[model samples]
Structures are given as structure tokens and as C-alpha cells.
Target: MMLNANLWWHDVDVVRRPPLEGDTDADIVIVGAGYTGLWTAYYLRKLDPTRNVLVVEAGHAGWGASGRNGGWCSAELPVGIGTLASKYGRSQALAMRQAGREAVNEIGRVIAEEDIECGWRKDGTIWLARNEPQRARLMAKLAEEREYDIGEGPTPVDPADLAVPGLLAAAHTPHCAALHPAKLAVGLAGAAVRHGVRIVEETRALEVRPGMVLTDRGQITARVVVQATEAYSGLLPGQIRRVLPLTSRVIATEPIPDALWRHIGWPGRATMSDQSLMFPYLQRTSDNRLVIGGRSIGYRYGAVPRTNHRDDERAWEVLEREIPTMFPALADIPISHRWSGVLGVHRDWQPRVTYDLATGLASAGGYVGDGVALSNLAGRTLAALITGTDSPANRLCWVGPPGRRWEPEPLPYLAIQAITALTALVDTRESRTGGSTGLAARLMGIAGK
Candidate 1:
């Protein structure tokens, strides 16, 4: 049940403490000490080092997807601006969007400034195409990128140029990056401690009544409470409804040959993914292993560990079969480690920051799978929102909640399952057919609804 790096954010040491045994007070109280909460403290201390900030976690720090994720520090390409603009507004969307891009830069800056060695990479992202429709979409998307002003070439990389098999094309993006996730988390926790932020692990926030957060062994009073729990937002009131969770799985191949690395010309050995709705993502570790994973939408977010455990064969099955399909030279590599984590897929697939100014209670969630970059950006932004600072965090486009209600169609859980199954079935099947899923596939994309 411990959510440490038994997954692939690589290894790191997290400080563990027993539950709070009594009362505490701080200027800020952050719940769920993953990437989001920790960054909240890290930045808060940066802006005002003298203030007391308490970070409480249900588990160890970064033990959630922050520790277990694929380690790709990417921008908000996964979610379209249409989603962004609709929820928050053009300026806010642009700011939120820019913040995600800045998040990666901030990470590198943090590592260098603080000298935290987290295997950070500034290479880029390559999204492979399984079939021609996917390839054509990339070609179109690359062209589309110019229109959206996502900077330079999201252009297609010919499969022939790499002498790889199976893949027809890959949209190579030079702006993205990767990192050793858990290492960054532990380092930040250490860094935050240096700045007077108090972090307590294994301390669950049992209840929140405006200024006081009650836990089993202790309670902390604050003028403002920020809930940074991304995956397990269900623990907080009204949070679970904001983000619809999808359990995504990842597996690392034992390590490919140096020959393969040379072929890919992975500049800084960047992170990569595919365009499939069930996105197949791959990135090279500092040690040369290729870690890849895709979505099995049929599985609920919470069941990833149990449903896709290493021995179940699907872990290796998905990676082995899918990795080489994206990069055929990697077709023979064996898997060494495998893990899964639940990601909060915010409705409309946009990252949202919501706070009731009257209540001074805020919750940040719904990064979809863009938590690595978006979460950090959101954490800092949430802190600024709470402190009433004019920091760039709030300038980002995604600054508020969905500000809507979930009109549950038929039932809650059952409807979600059926939609997931249908979407996966149609998406995977259409992917095999090689082009866009057409109108039928488009409609099925909402099967969960």
C-alpha cells in the first residue's frame, strides 16, 4: 500500500514521520504532499521564507504519480487550448499554458540552482504514429502547431530516416523534456526543509473545517488550506467530481542496446509517446532502459496496481509489443520493471485551480496525464492565489475550477465503466484500421459518458 517508487520515477529517499501527535499552526497548510503540495511549499518558502507552511500527506512525499510516473516533464500538448479557453478564458488559458512550459524550465533551473541531481533532460518529445491515419494526423498536427503558435516544428520524422520498422512517422517536438521524478521530489522536500517548511508523512488529513485540518494524531490551524492531492482528490469534498480518473500503466524494458540509442539520435535521450487515444509513451532512462506504457481504458484508475501487476503478463505485453511498434529496433528488448499509477483526467481535459475566496479553501486537480509539469505549475499558482500575490502562477490561463456540475447520465460508477470499455474497444480497433477513427470513433470517444 506504500506508494513509493516501486514504479519508475527511479529511486530516492523520502523522509517519513509518524502522524502528527498534537496541535500545530502555520501560515499555510497544504494537503496531499505529492508534487503539487510540495511545490506549493517550495515556492511559498521562496516568496516568503519566514512564514510557517505545513505539508501533510496521506502517504510518503511524492509517493503518488509524482514518484511513480514515466518521468516525462512535458507541456500541456495533451490537452487542447479549446479545453483551456472554454474553462478559464483566453488570457488565463495562455497563462496556464505558458506556466506548464515554464514549469519544465523551472525544474531545470531548480536542479541547477539547488544542484539537485535528478537526471533531468531537456531533449524533447517524439510522439510515434502506429498507422497512417495517426501519421497523417501528425503531419496535419505539425502543420497545425504553426497555427497555434506552439513554437517551431512539431514536424514529422520519417521512419525511414531512423531505419526503424513498423512506425510510419513520429512528430518530434523539441520543447519538451524529462527527469528523474522521485529524485526531484526528495530533493525538493529536502530543499523545502532548508527553508523552514515542515513536512509530515503518514499523516492523513481526516477533516478540514476552514482554518483547521484535523488528522488522526494532530491538527493544524491555518488562515488558508490548499488541497494539492491530484489522484486521490476523492478524499476532499467536491474534488472527486472535478477530475475523472483514468488508471494508466507503465513498464520499463530491461535496457536496450547502445546500438538502439545511437539509431534514435535521442539528443539528450528525451521522452516520447504516440498519438493513440491509448497513448503509448517511451523514454530512455539515464541507464539506457526504455520505459513505455499505454492506457487500458477499461481499467479504473484505482485498480492499476492490482489489474496490471507485473506478473499478470499485460505489463510486459503492452510495452514489448507497443514499444517496438513505435521504434522497431527496440522490438526485442525485454522488460525489467513495470508499474502503474492513477492520473486525474480533469473533465474537459484541462488543468483547473479552484478556490472559494469566501472560504479561503482551494483545490487544484485535473491535469489529465500532464501532472508532471502541470502539477508543479499548478502548485506554485495555487500558492500565489492563496497568498494574494501577483506571481505568474495566476497569470496562466487555467486559473479556476470547471465551475459546472456533473449531470450524471444514468449511474455514476457503472456508466463510467461502460463508457471506458466502449471507448477503448473502438479506439484500439480503429487504431488498427490505420486512419482516423472517423465519426464513429469520434462518437465513441465519449463512450464513458
Candidate 2:
């Protein structure tokens, strides 16, 4: 079957579910079939065997960002240590980081226990510094990690180790792993079904209220309703600003030859990236393909898509240009796939979990571009809160904040466009001049505060 959204699904066989027909009533209702919804459904069944759970999806499972991501299940939270420390105190901030690391391992544990066939490798990730500004930025992050003992912070690696050109220094951390994203998503959906959770696909949820969800098919009334629609949450009534849908584009190259692999010398297959404002993330597929993603190449005006295609030519051009610049040795490699997907971005760019006991409404998202692992973390937290388990994951610092919505229409659109343009300009200027440009530093300062 031809993959609808991503290269990761090209060879995998997905089991499809028919759309919901007629009105349905359940004990728990989820509004999205992506990772968050499926994971929540899965855990709810595991926690309470008698609860009637139903999941509704706009497209197939994994059709959203869950299927089209960089595939680095990194141990990084959406928020940084210092920011978390300032907001929730230092100990809670440290506990948040520890929970993130556990979540990463938990993904592996669950995949193995469930016998999911996703290609998973615990090879870790590396951030390369190709310029002085990038090197300084990398070191600044490292200094903070070292100061706080925040797990295995980036370690310095030699330029020769990466076999890439113009590498000043490199930072390596074992806190990340590479996986086939679509496989994990589809696997989770299948696993949830096997555990007695009902999932309905191709069912668009128009509105999600406290105890009911209005869908294209029909209405679903349940005791508890979860608005798990990450990027598409804007489409719902009264949630246009809960999260902004920012487009992230990616391209995958044909399998490289063994001789080229010898030159690349990435036996560990570490997910790689460079330090740039508009930086790219890299992953080597199990089938030996190269997949890379560029950040926020296109922004949806008013948090909505302008076209159905969603793919941007400028973003594709950036991938083509950056790949050769990073590795001249692989300049001859051909791009096999080009696809784009949008991810949710909070105004503060922090991932959060919100649940109201009185309303029986809950949500977990706003992961920015780091949702792959953070989504799993959000799933566990949402499950605990819904079931009244009183677990540590539910009480974490990220769960307390009632995230402010985005600015009104024209303002959000304008702000996103200006930030994207400014960041691109900053990256360009920093690449040319090795001096201490305060562009990224200033942006970081403002964002953290």
C-alpha cells in the first residue's frame, strides 16, 4: 500500500477501522487517534478493565505528527531545567527531567512487552557544532546540564568522529533512541484494540465539550471527554489558541551504499543534528535511508492550513541544500521522499497536561517539535489524572500550569511569521560571522523567561 503521509509507513501494513456510525455512548471518549489518544485508551483499559473506552480519529491512526516526526525519542522535556527550576523550584525541575528519562525507557519496555515490530535502536543522538556561535550555544547548554547533574549531558566529540565537514566540535548523549515512528503509532493502535479499546477512524471531531464530542459521523456522549487533538485542536470551538499549528517538513534519501557507510562511520546510528536556529535533525533508518527534518519551514496563518497539500517547496529546497552542506561526501545521494506535517506549539512553547475534575475534561499536548517522547509522557500523566491513581507522573510540575491561549488571529499569524523570518536571518548571520551574536541568546532568554 502507498503511504499516505510519511516514508516510515511505506512498507508497513496498517489495519484500518471503519468510521463510526450512529450515536455512540461510552464511559471515556478520546478525540484523536494519534499517539496521545491511543496511549490514553490503552492505559485506561489496563488500569480499569470495566471502563468502556472509545477513540475517534480524523484520519487513520498515526496520520498526524505522530507518524511524521524526526524519530528521535529523546529524553529532553519541552521545558529546560532553569526554566522549570524558576517556575516550580529546583527539586521539582530535576524530578521532571528524571521522569522524562523514565518515560523514554518506558516506551522501550512497553514496545517489547507488547511485541511491537517497530525498528527500535538505543543508539542515542549527537548535536554537531559547525560554527563558533553554534559551539558556544552547545557549550552553554552543556554547562547548565553539568551544573545540575541533569543525566548524561552532551559530551564533546572530535570532528573526525562524525566524518562531516566543517565540524568544530560535537556533543553526544545517550538519552535518545531512533525508531520507525509510523510503526510505533500503528503498533500502539493495534495493541490498544487487542486490549478491548474501540477505535473509529476517518471520523472528524468538530467540537469537543466537557461530556460530549460533536463529530462528522454523529455525536459521542461519554462520562469523560479528552481533547487529544494536538495540532488540529484549533479546529474545535473555543480552542483556536490552545495551540498553534506550525509546519515541520522532512525529506528521506535512498539507501546509501556500504562504502558510503564506511566513510560515514555511524555504526551506532545516532540521531544527528547541527546547532542552528533553523537547524535540521537527522536519522539513519534501519533500511539504511537518511531522514532529516527542518524546523518550522512554513507556518499556518491563524493556526490553519492554506492548502490541502500542506507541503512547501521552500522547505524541500532547504533540505536539499542543507544535506549537501553538512556532508559533501554524500552529495550524490538522491532524495526518495518529501513530506510535511504540522505540530502544536504553545505560546510559551512548554508541554503541559490539563485536567479538570468537575468538568471531566482533560488534554495533553503543546510539545512544540519534541512530541515523539513527550507525547508518551503526556499519555501516562493524562491516564493517571483520569483514573484518580495519584501517581507521580500526574503531580509533576508540567501538570499544574493552566496554559494561556495564543493571541488573537492576525496577531498569532504575524508573530509566527516574524519569528520564523528573524530566526532564519539570525542563523544566516551567525554562520557567516564567528563572533558572539546575541540573536539566539536573546531569543532563548526571552523564551525561558
Candidate 3:
């Protein structure tokens, strides 16, 4: 097994495509071969097979957060529905939420149509409330969902169903699915290739300009250029603060025995996470291994993005401790892998899909770690916008201007660290007292807005 390699990567073999060798021209050029880029490329050709579409990747496809994430294809957005309604109006917020739900099924439809076998399971997600405070928060959220009449919103589940210590309540929502992220990424790349999309791997995009993409290999001129780098957007010149990069670490346990799994009691294998401020997300792999991940690390100064953090002992240590703490049955299980990846966070904590017809520049990202399903929506929306499809997706709230840029360095770095530290502290206080800290709400307002 490779150190710091995504556990999902273990399920597939990666072969790099030929890199760009010289200056080229295309109908559409997209930088970053992650889900957003590949999905856009896949859909663009689907919409119009005659268009020349090219995708350039710094590494191989799925090398970034796309392949390294927690494998959650969830409809949950980074910001809450209420927050969206407050900012973009109620109808638009509801429309965006509905779009997310549809996006989950859309991904499933594509996977089945493409015949990509990536352990696709629509088992949904389970959110655990481990303390009184967490329970109150969950109930409040459920009430809000009811108030908005969101379809199939989270419903209560018996805490006993989770079989975790101190669990006071649980909620399940069908709008999430679990899958092998790397396999999905690789498979999408293959699907795009089959659809006449050219993917150039190991080609670093230096900068993206109007109708042009400058790369290490050569310049690419196209009628339209899309920037889908997400967290790595900071690596490009003049985009240092466009999106902040935050590190998330993950650890995977060796396959648990059938008897032990039965004792643990998640028969559906629904993706699971607690309501803790520094929450940890868990998933059961098709092979029966347990994967857990969380935001165990804070932002780096200057928003630098690193491919691997194998040397980050502190982050891995935090994740390693979570397995035993959350599930005593796994106390002795060996952790087979540990890895870390960076996710993009916009200033408003909302994802966006923007296309500027005047400059032939387009972009979609800032998913804040909830991008698996959202990326599909963005791709379809981007394709619709670029091809003049006049679809309803273009009317979604995210299909407008890129929101405010993150504050200059030191400020973002400091604020992120403070929030991270405060979150941990609040979780600790809530756990010990079994009462509301009253700080989480304040923090959410400041952090997301």
C-alpha cells in the first residue's frame, strides 16, 4: 500500500494519459481533471459531440480532492438552507436544494449508464447526536426541514440503531450515497475519453486567462476556458485568495469480521457522522473496511495546497483516535491507511458555477468538502450554460458571479485557526456538560458569512 495514497485509489489502477506537448486550440479547454472538469467535458461532448474539448490535469485524473475525499456523494451544501434563503431568497434556496437532491440521482444515472462499478450504493447517510446539545441541534435542523417542506428531509432514528456510546439521537436522509471516489473519478475520465474528450495528464496549468490556459507543456487557446482547480486554484497566479484551502485527514481500518460488524449494527452501511463541531465522517467500504475522515488540521499560511501530508503525524493521530472513541468494537482494529487532502472554501461557504460569456471564462468549485454530488450538478449546469441549452439548471442560484474573495493571507489563516480551535473547545464543553455552548451558532454565522 502506498503511504498517503487515498484508500479509494487502492480499488483501481491509474494510468496517466499523454501530456500536452505543444500549443493547441480547442472549442473548450478545461484545467484540472477532477470531477468538475471531467464532468463538464463529459457533458459538453454529450450535448454537442462535434465540439473540441480538452482537459489538462496536473497529475493524473482524480489526483486532487476528487479522489482523496471521504467518498460522500451527498446533496448537502456547505451552507444551510436557511442561510441560502436569507441571502438568495426562499424560492431560489429551495430550488438549489432540490437541484442537489436531483444531482444525487443524476450521478447514479450516469454511473449506471456508463457501467462504472465503483461500489455505488444509495444507502443514504446517518447523522448521530452523541450528546444532549447535539440532539437539540439535530431536532432543530429537522424542524427547519419540515418548515421548508424539503422533500424527504432527515427523519429521526433510534440512537440504539447506531450502537455508539453516548448517542442520544440519530437522523437519516436518503439524499446521500457512498461510493469509491477514485474509481468514480477514473471511470468518469474514461467515459469522457470515450465521448471524444481529450485528457492530457501531468500537465500543470500555470494560469487561466480569458479564452486561454497557460500550462507547463504549452499554451491552450479555446473559445472557452474553464477553471476547475478547486482548492488548487490558489496555486494559479492572481487567485491566491480566491478560495482558501483547508486540510482534511482520513484513516481506514482493516476489514472487520462479519460477527464484529453485526455487533456494531449498521446493517445498511449508511454513511455516518456525529454532530460534533469537529465531526468525523465514517463509511463502510464494500470490502468491509471502515473509512473515517475529518477536518483535523487547519489552513496553512498563504493558502498553500499540498498533494500529500503523509508526514502530518498530528493530523493522523487525531483520526486514529476517533475510531476507537466512536466504536469500541474497532478499538483493536489496525488502521491500514492514513491520508490527507485539501478542500476549497469560498468566503460565503457556498459552492458556485459561474460563466462569463464576455471573456469566455467559466469556473465551478468551492464545495467545502460536500462536492461529490454537487460537482455533477455544476458540470451539467456548466455544460448547459456553455452550449446555450437554456435549461433550468442555469437559473439555479450558483450560476452567477463568483462571490467575494477570501481575505488576504494572515487574516484567513488566523480566523480559520481560531474557528478550528474554538470548535474543538465547544465540542469538548458540550460533551462534558451535555449542554449547549451557545457559541456554535455565533461561530457558524461568522465562519460562513
Strongest candidate by lDDT: 3
Q: Record all residue pairs in model 2 with backbone atoms less than 3 Å apart, i.e. clashing.
A: none
Q: Which one wins by TM-score: 1 or 3?
A: 3
lDDT of each: 0.69, 0.83, 0.87
Q: For residues 149-222, what per-residue lDDT tens digits would candidate 1 score against the true structure?
A: 64554666766655445667776776677777788788888888788888888888888768888887688999
Clashing pairs in 3: none
By lDDT, is 1 or 3 better? 3
From the highest TM-score down, the ranking of the candidates is 3, 2, 1
Query: For model 3, how does the per-residue alpha-carbon lDDT over 1-449 read when each residue is reduced to its tens digit?
Result: 42555688776899779999999999999999999999999999999999999999999999999999889999888888888888889999899889999999999999999998888899899988889988887887788788767668777788786569888889899888989999999999999999999999999999889988999999999999999999999889878788988888888888888788888888766899887777888889888889999836657788888633444667788788878778898899988888888889898888999999999999999999899999999999999999999899999988899889988868997888888889888888988899887798787677452
* Candidate 2 residue-wise lDDT at 368: 76
TM-score of candidate 1 against the unseen true structure: 0.88
List all candidate RMSDs to the true structure. Answer: 3.6, 2.0, 1.6
My TM-score estimates for the predictions, one after another, are 0.88, 0.96, 0.97
Model 1: lDDT equals: 0.69
Evaluated at residue 186, the lDDT of candidate 1 is 81
Q: What range of 10 consecutive residues in model 1 has the weakest lDDT sum?
A: 297-306
Clashes of each: 10, 0, 0
